[model samples]
Target: MNSLSRMLEVLNLFKPEQPVIDIEVICSQLGYTSASAYRYVKELSNAGLLVRLPRGYALGPRIIELDRHMTQFDPLLAASRDIVGDLIAQTHLELLISELYDSTVINILQRSGADEQALNFGRGRPMDLFRSATAKVILAYLLPRQLKRLFDNAAPGDLERIGLTWKDFSKAMLRIRKDGYCISEGELDPGKSGIAAPIFDEKGRILGSITLAGNSERFNAFNREFLSTLMIDAARKITSRIAG
Candidate 1:
């Protein structure tokens, strides 16, 4: 990999569970020698992308600054904040505004209701493409070529767990497209169910998804048609607002 790509790989290692990593840990995890790990970490630290923590290394202040900038200027987030706020108020469910960037589904905006359980994801957190309702809606909208690439690169048996084969998975996606929404029950987080609908850009490209999440019991208590209609309407409104 190029130096830039290697640097990003290093940054990607710093996740929620392993937020602080030292040179030794990086070397072992990435199968790099001490020299290579130190070189990569040094370059990142020099660029202000990695900070030297007392224990190890953590994402530096630069990341936080960039996140702030993105949150302030992102068009979709700006357009949907108030609308999502309204959804949370109306349904009393946790609402997530997520987007498909390349093939990675990211939770970009979220609002939680008083009684709803908070999800593990947050702004910039990568949502599981195969698991979360928000991710599945976006996945269902991928171009054929994109879908093929994703399927080819995915870990084995992922398609099977979702449906059993490519044909089954395709049919499931078709159903989602026809209905304009998707619902998942305890698929990602146990006991948490979610309903999601896709948003499209002016060019009709899939932009992302808007999701309402709640405890499965609470979610089951609501009328399916009513909740799906509300989710679809919210997704459409966000799409239109951003497209405009």
Candidate 2:
């Protein structure tokens, strides 16, 4: 990795489980010498990306500030805010707006009714690559080359979850694109089901997806066709808003 990449990698090391990291841990995990690790930490601290604590270094307040900016200014979130609220009022189900960041699908916004089950997927969390309706709908609109690259790197289990072979995977994605939406049940979370439709940019490039999720029993009991149509219409509205 280049120097800039190495420097940025330090930020990736912080996770929910390991929120604080010391210099020794950084050196051990990143294979950097004590001197280089300290230098990186110092620079990151100076930039307000890391805050030094008595125990270790924790993520700094800059991340929170950036999150606030994204909440207020992200075009996708801004476009979908009212639309998502409307969907929640209509369906009384959990709703998510997710975007593909490189190869990762991240849920950027969520809304849920009071009686809804606690969802494993939440705002700012990464969704499953193959199992989530949110991710699947977005993936269906990806370029063939991009799909192939992800397929080549996928684990055997992940491949099997979608299909047994490359052709099968390709067919599944094609079907979703043709249908303009995806439905998944008990894939990412047991007893949870979702329907998702893709949103697009002005150029018609896929930007993200909007999904509605609920308890599988309740989801199946509802008029799925009606729900699906609602989700598709909502997604199109968000896309148009983005373009406008």
Candidate 3:
């Protein structure tokens, strides 16, 4: 990879859940020897994309700036807007399309197609995993260490209360990551339901997630199995279009 791409690649190693990584982990991603990984780490640190901790490198502020620039013109919005509009025309349910950001999702764009209250997450609304299907699905696929940090940060003692032990959470995340999708019921809001799946780029990195969501009654009126299938297919279609 070129310098810019390589820098971005290294930055990609830091997830919202796992913001810090050791030299070994970086080496594992690149399959490089310690020396090579160290060299790149040094270069990335010099460029301020990486902040070296004792055991791992945390993402620095530079990456946050880069992220702002990329999502300013989100492809998911540009490419999927019309398609999402058409889907809503047929389905009647609103769309809450979003891309995963650090431990959250910023709804870059959305389409409601319905004349009723238009539903679109604004440009900078910070959404969390607790109340968003897209956020949960993205969280399910996030790096384990990063997820742990989130869980710990959000609710330390509550994990056991919710039957969400670290081990159980890990197992669930593994399954979700394997399935590449999630169906959430009241995971975010009391009456809100959603189905979501990942969108990927050419290198198989998750670009973001797209979700189909509506009032519980409207969603319950439809065949969830079919809707889930459609959403998953749509995710693949979007990914393929971008990757192509």
Candidate 4:
């Protein structure tokens, strides 16, 4: 691998569970020579991307600062904050807020009303549509050109099985645009259900969405049409807040 790629490879050796790890483990995982790994690690540490923690090299606060800077001016988050909070209050369930970037779901913020111990994500988490209802709603709203670009960048035949070709996909999107909500069962995760509605500005531009989410049993008992109405109402309230 190239130098930059190899440095990134070493960075991945640290996870939440093993936030600090040794050079030996890093070399084994990245298949780099011990000296090369050490050199890269030392460089990264000096640059503040990695830190020499008690255990080994853990990510430093600089990365956190980078993450904060990335999210500080994200318009979608600025626009949709209130709507998500309202959804949490009314449904007493969790909300997963995400936006599309480069056709992949990039930014995520979690909202919860209940204990939330059952929720498995957090603010600033990145998500995938293949694993979320939030992804489906965002995808259902993109223009045809954007959708084509997304497909071209995705696995050659991966999205075809999900049936989002231009013809049918446009129609599906129009439905959400008209009714302002999407109800899908077990789309985000096994046994999870979601009710999401698009949040639109006064100019009728779609910002993102507000989703009411819960695990299988609680979600299954929810009335889709009822949840749809709630989400649509929540979106309207949130849009007004954003506009103000």
Scored by lDDT, the top model is 2
What lDDT tens digits, residue by residue, belong to model 3 across residues 1-244? 6756664676667666777888888778867678867888888888878887887888777878876776566566666766687678778777767777766787766666443644444444667764556776777766667877877776644354233677777776677677767776665555666778888777877678887776677777888778877888888888888887
Give a tens-digit lDDT track for model 2, residues 59-174. 99888999999999999999988888888888788999999888889999988854446678889888657778899999889999988988898888887767768999999999
Candidate 1 clashes: the total is 0
TM-score for model 2?
Answer: 0.95
lDDT of 4 by residue, 60-114 (tens): 7789887787567655666666666666776788886655554566436676656
Candidate with top TM-score is 2
Residue 44 C-alpha lDDT in model 3: 84
**Candidate 3 residue runs with Cα over 4 Å from true position:** 1-73, 113-123, 156-163, 187-189
Ranking by lDDT: 2, 1, 3, 4
Q: Please list the residue runs of candidate 1 whose C-alpha ends up more than 4 Å from where it truly belongs after superposition.
A: 31-39, 122-124, 155-157
Range of the 10 consecutive residues with the lowest summed lDDT in candidate 1: 156-165
The model with the greater TM-score, 3 or 4, is 4
For residue 155, what is the lDDT in candidate 3? 64
Ranking by TM-score: 2, 1, 4, 3
The pairs that clash in candidate 3 are: 17-146, 18-146, 131-188
TM-score of 4: 0.65
Model 2 spans > 4 angstroms off: none
Error in Å for residue 120 of model 1? 3.5
Collision pairs in model 1: none
